[model samples]
Target: MIHSKRSDRNNISPQAGLLIWAIIFLVLATAVLNMPGYPSGLKPATFLKLPLEVPLTGLALLVLSGLAARLLAFFSTLAIGTVLFLRLADIGVQSAFQRRFNPYLDAKMIADGWNVLSGSIGTLTAASLIIATIAVFILVLLLLFTAQVRLADAKPPITGNLRLVFGSLAGVGLIFFTASQFDGMRQYASLQTPSYLTARLTLISKSMDDMRHFDQDLAARAEKTTDEYLFRGVAGRDIILIFIESYGRSAVEDSRYAPLIQPRLASVGDALTAKGFSAASGWTRSPTMGGLSWLAHGTFLSGLWVDNQARYDRLMISDWPSLNSMFRDSGWRTAAVMPAITMAWPEAEYYGYDQIFAAADLGYKGKTFNWVTMPDQYTLSAFDRLVRHPAAEADKPVMAEIALISSHAPWTPVPRLIDWLDVGNGEIFDRQAESGDPPGVVWADDQRIRRQYIQTIDYSLHTVGDYVAKFGDDAVFVVLGDHQPAPLVTGPDASRDVPIHIISRDRNLVRRFEAEGFSPGMIPAEDAANPPMDSMRGKLIRIFSQAQ
Candidate 1:
């Protein structure tokens, strides 16, 4: 009786162990499916209907490897953890930009995003999320490793030709299922284990194919681009393109922010009028949202929809002519004033500018406020001193793109505009730089965040207005936002439209925008039809070159 009891207990033990392993596999798979940016229709319940091939195939590989099962498990854990981390990062990119993430291409630009991450580290919201993700990764790996060690010494659950046959069938079925779903299952069950991997793999392959055709596409577009002779309408005019960081349509048109920003908009209008500069405003769709200002900049300059990192990387390598290049080709000096750039930027070479002013070269000795490298006032002041000031004296026409970055993410410790003369190399603003609340404290409340974001936009507008008032007589100003603020401030599903204002002392330059559908002054008309950012290159060329 004791022997029979022992045999029965052994059988039960193997079954229970198999059951536990099955449960663990299911849990891990579900966790990946539920990550942010997952397909909306996918739920935990959907896993109940999924085929058993994925989990079964994993087990088959372990059982077939026999004594090496523990090693296989360790490697499997590493692979799954990496995929999960990628999914999490994609979720973050989607939430902010409303786009899918491509790790294969974006990984190359990790150095570029590092500066952005370092600047915003004080915001516990983003930092904590990253920390929690890494912690989870480590914990999951440890659990899997422990399970492998515990199971490695256990007696074989089953051993026979029958077992091998079952394992082979499971493996073959998994391969066939993944191949079949590679194209047809794009929308449904996309976040499921097999489907998710298949979909991402397909997209990755497509991106590669697109890159192969990128040069041909760019050359075709170049044929329609404005010629060098087209800039004559505005020849000898200093053209300055200013990109206001995170200044979106929501800041100007959303009811939550309009009350705070409208007054400043009105003031900007009054200030420009008082200075004898005519201004017209309208909207344009940005290629990116919340962040990734470079995409928007490239779109406007290259006349291509550089919506992803693959396209962006290609543009950096190609010999495509840009707005800057056009100016360069037309005997005008070109420069890029990028305050957020803290490291070497190879893209500057692609733009073909004569002068480049990054944060390090800007000569600012003030306290860094949150993510903003320097205050917008200081950035504009530096541009004046470095580029515009000398251009005025040398009698040279300059074309420059100045990125004003005070209103960047984690908007806090916003510096108010001071007397331009006192702004002297940005050191004088140290007194007010530490006056506002830190991002960690302010971001704790959503309403306060929204309010502060609006205030930041207001400050940027006033600073630009002040610039035009101080130096409007000799330049044509093209001011626009890079992208909308992150969804947190704009709420969900806000438009990607950003207000663009063209201010100039020449009445003809301002009136020319009217034919292309711009409003009279400072604020774009409520019902004006906004075009995409890529369309601006041709439109500007056509307008300024008299091609219209």
Candidate 2:
């Protein structure tokens, strides 16, 4: 099997030509099938059973495309993508650590957080090594591939590196294509286009204004209604709004999951029933699902309908009075204890808080080297020790912001207990997995996640309730969801609605909600639905003001 022409050996023969073509075909078929695209917005069933038979019709595309002067751009862009994707994972892990530690930047707390973070150095180091290897390998191949090609010598146009050239062309074409999505999104862009962005922002602003007015009016009514709640009135009540991460109405309504949450809430509802607290529920807007806590928080506090980098930048340039400002004006001392917000949340200062306790401000002494700001339980613990304690200026009523981080996703390493750990809190992680749930396959797959999430919410409710109970008849606890959970937990078409619950162990206060049409477990009817990004204070103050 050795006879071959020496001159012809330099060129690829028919057999080699056929083999390369086959290899290229398979690579395109397999790799291209997985390419991300527009996501049709259609269900799997609809795709499979569409009116016509269209296999491989509308789902192939590459993400993060770009244009370059050289032919090596495909491999270069792919290499960049892989690096960025790994970094995103690292970011997520850091977020989880932030959540787990819920560290207040007090020296002691920072020390504790450092200890926990140090434990994850090994993982970070490994990830760095892998990324470095990928970069080096890609760079070497790039140099070789470019060197082998003769850019100047062109006889037969088809004989060159057609794959790299075509891929580059496709990337350039796509960049221009996606930018057009912004054309219709702008105001007064085109007669044929819908200015959806401006319209949504307008509606959001109206909702924010309504809520501010309602809070002021309610505080006035609260002063007149009762003697028990008057340090000055409901304004004097220390508000502890708890936002359970990724919690959905389905978590409590679905029979499959209801058992996990109903018992605890039923008890909570009963306790609040004896007190004068009423509850209601509805929706809010959010940019992302499975993550992105700031989207919900920013939309609620800023009134500017900010869900992306563009809108967020626009808000920073403006000065707006948030709910914090409203409370500050009423003479209640306000403080924001948010660990989730990493960068300087400028709105906090502009809104006029007496004290702003970011993640660093809280004196946390624990370890964390993950994605979130702090575990929900730890967030509650920080609240108990920091804001709920009696202060030297006893007469100054406090309005505190306590954002809960429980039930957030992708629900890993969930906390099982709500014990307050002053020093060794970093050890709190998930329980050992039980491998014997053969019958519970689907349920175990998703339920393990949902179950832990529900448990976290339960712990948050109990802890917050305990703290409020300690505040006695002198305080009013306003605990409401910032927004509904993402669609992954709530279903693809889930509404933005979130439930609001207020509590106080005062009977006269209990009569207030009864006079109005609300109970401890009450949810607002769908008919009363205030659309996306509606002010929660607006919804709450109105009913209580009318009751007074």
Candidate 3:
């Protein structure tokens, strides 16, 4: 009889055992539901408030039984898992693009990100990282599923008092959700998973509607005639539109970078002025901030806001003529020097290039600087030899778009400006490519990354300045930034405005740009009129053509 009494004292009843499992499930659910949407939002206080979904799911499980309860638990777990994954994606997209991820529009970024990752690191390492990320995601889903199943399989049913408690908790959750919508009560509100899901759904719906409107805008732009383009002012000059990667206003305005970058800009501007190259700089708001350079390129060329991948894709298929094509239509040879394009670029046809100098065609014998195929100086040299010099020799004016990528991410082993003659086939840059710290070491510290970024920008700017001073005798150079670097380097609140400099020996051309709101030096005015990038096409055509 004493042994039986001892056994009874130690053993828990079925209801008590299930109650313990339920509590464990509630804790796990609460943690998952309280996960913040941004990396900066992750703090100790983030988990202090309760999540509404936990109590609501518990109440549903309490009310159901058998297959109904099991099905509810399974779907609830799936929903929670999805929320967790999307929240993580949101943090990543916010860091890279300064915006939240849109499932409908941003799916292409996955493949692009993989390419950049494999290029920066090795393909094997990138693949392994992807596999590990997938494994962790799957493990998280499994844990959620197990907890949900345990909650559903509670034995001896919950008591009336517990049911009443769950119902009251669920009601409290609804009240918290309602409070979150009010300005005064929002600070006291708890995290609501349901609200997050609802917001994402709304965002998806809005994205679809936006794409439809974008298609209409593209159609409207495509209906214009080629007769509208007549670039007669300074008709004999070669126009080189050079895009300097990641060259944003922050390079000249941010306190950390300005001290180093502004001095270089002033020196370059002084040298250019002495060489009779008048320059006017201004700010233009790019469609994209951190990455996706093609969007800005398309917007600048097409006179349409190609802000997302969907818009860019649609713009490519439309009948609209790019700036290069407009120049091509008006009796000028057009070419593109794209060092970052390692593979086939069928889009060159759409841009109406008479010749294309891709990465492989550039004849670079040097080692690549991380993701940069070649240094900016080498790229400029190749353009001079392969396209610019040849066109000048033949006396055929050319409108060429040259992409200078030395300032791109993984900004290490920055190449110095060398004499144009020494940049033959790019062999001279091999040693410099191996000089500085690798990306792995540099990226470990934020300050180091910023310094490297500043160095690269300075290098690219000096390269352009020197190249133009030597080779730009009768040419016009419209040098601009593709976009800003990622938020990790520029901080989260950096502007989307990038600096654009029009450098030429023709003072009349510089004066025309000045009349259109550009300031008279390498540094743009602090309050310069920040026009949309898409407006560049119309501005150039109107300013240079007989229409002016």
Candidate 4:
């Protein structure tokens, strides 16, 4: 009875309840302070005020009704963690519980991320997390025991509320730390927010914008300019539109960067000239840089600039026709070959392709380094196999959209000849080449990455050029850069422009593009006064549809 009375009296003290929290603050501060570099730009006041910050801030917020209870925080942590996990799982290879998450990874559905400071957490990361969590629990307990801390308030809430508060706080701390480290959480995640966030944002859209922006334009363009794209009795030739990862005209124009490579592409371009094939180039606006390759690819494919996770989700739910599905309606064999995607993506099914080939469908012939899949050459090779569909309806044309990834990040193990392509140990990612080397002669900057990317494009274009020459008017090819490289090439912006090139043996295809006020050049439709990426889909489709 005496001991029970003493324990009850002890519970009244803030020093007893808060002893662990105080220790946690010190431990966290120490760990963060000891990071590789010194913390700059932080004021001494910020450092000094931290000890009192947590509780004092709580009190201040409470006075202002801004203080959120620990229970709410705990749930927020779990909700956000689940959101992050789901996002990764949606694009993951291994199962959600076992696999890691990568946010800034250059390739699609990558098992990990690529930033020097951030990356996906795999088994090693998970084990570390479990250990750290235990350590935090122990440390907090030790501090409480040592300090005999208790709450500052004299009158206390029920004991059940106390447990909820502590439990929630622990959960909140764990998630807060994780979110700080995970790239996806920082930039692309919003799971903690209410579900109505989407409805609220979309509801803000003005009704002035109508579906006619998409439908009427098609109807009008078809009525007036449809004749040229149609060749005699041909409905629509099988369109094999490809986006060679980072292919761009700048790779050719910048001689000092790729003196040897630029000429090879120019030579390849010139050779096509005499073969009655002409190449015209233009630009599209890429929404992001360094990463988010999918957003650009999504914009081109869906004919909508899908800039965020929300936009990406809404489209997936829609029954609207993608370019591939549109071709499917024409009785064309529609397929998408994505070598970068290691696992199946739900978005692929939504887009409506007759057959979808993922990385599993691909033959991973050991090409790697700086983390990537086979070269674009292999993708083209795969396409060639698909092209000779021996059993399918021979009369029906095919529409194949292929994405080439060899030109992607950590450009290394880049083969001089496509046949010799092997990612191998990625020695190139580590090598330091002289800055002045031509495009073919790899350099050390973004251009080095670009050189590799552009060469892949050159090779793919040349390959397409060769394919056309061999096929002899049986097919049509559309090739362009899905998006610009990154901040290294084009700085981060909503409006950074990307180059778009349309190459074909068909003169009418080129004519159709020009009649819409877009001629050969790396340019977006954005004029001194024109619409932005918002208008790209309707235009490209209206032009390409005519070939039907």
Give each model a TM-score.
Answer: 0.81, 0.58, 0.92, 0.55
Error of 1 at 359 (Å): 2.5
Q: Which ten residues in a row have the lowest lDDT in candidate 2?
A: 51-60
Q: Which stretches of candidate 4 lie over 4 Å from their true place?
A: 1-236, 246-265, 362-371, 388-393, 418-474, 488-495, 521-534, 545-548
Q: For residues 1-548, write the lDDT of model 4, one tens digit per residue.
A: 99999998777465444545544534443222222111221344333212222332233222221123333333433433333333333222122111223222223333333231122123445457556755854564444323222222212343235445544554555565456556655411112234432432343342113332434343443222233343332355667777766544344344433565445546655766667776665555555444556666667767666654445555676655576676676567888888878765888877788888877675554434334456555566666665545345466677888887766654544533333233232233223221223332343455565555555555555655555545535566666665545434432222345456565667667767666655553232334222345466677666665533
Query: Which sequence of candidate numbers ranks them by TM-score, best first?
Result: 3, 1, 2, 4
TM-score of 2: 0.58
Candidate 1 lDDT tens digits, 1-548: 99999898777566466546545654664455455564432465544333443346345444655557767666666656666776776766655676667866667655545555545546456567667778987887676555554444334543343245446645655666566577764322232555766788898898888877876797565453346666887888899999999999999889999988888988899988998989989999998896888999999998888877778888988878888988888878999999988888888999989999999999999888867779998988888889887644756688999999888867788779888888886778787778877777787888988888888899999999988998767688899998998777887678999999989988887899987899988888889988999998888887788632
User: What is the Cα-based TM-score of model 3?
Assistant: 0.92
Off by over 4 Å in 2: 1-11, 14-233, 274-288, 341-347, 367-378, 410-412, 416-447, 470-472, 483-491, 505-530, 540-547
For residues 86-147, write the lDDT of model 3, one tens digit per residue. 88788878888888888889987898877766765557777998899789778777776776
Best by TM-score: 3
Which pairs of residues collide in candidate 3?
Answer: none
- Which candidate order results from sorting by lDDT in descending order? 3, 1, 4, 2
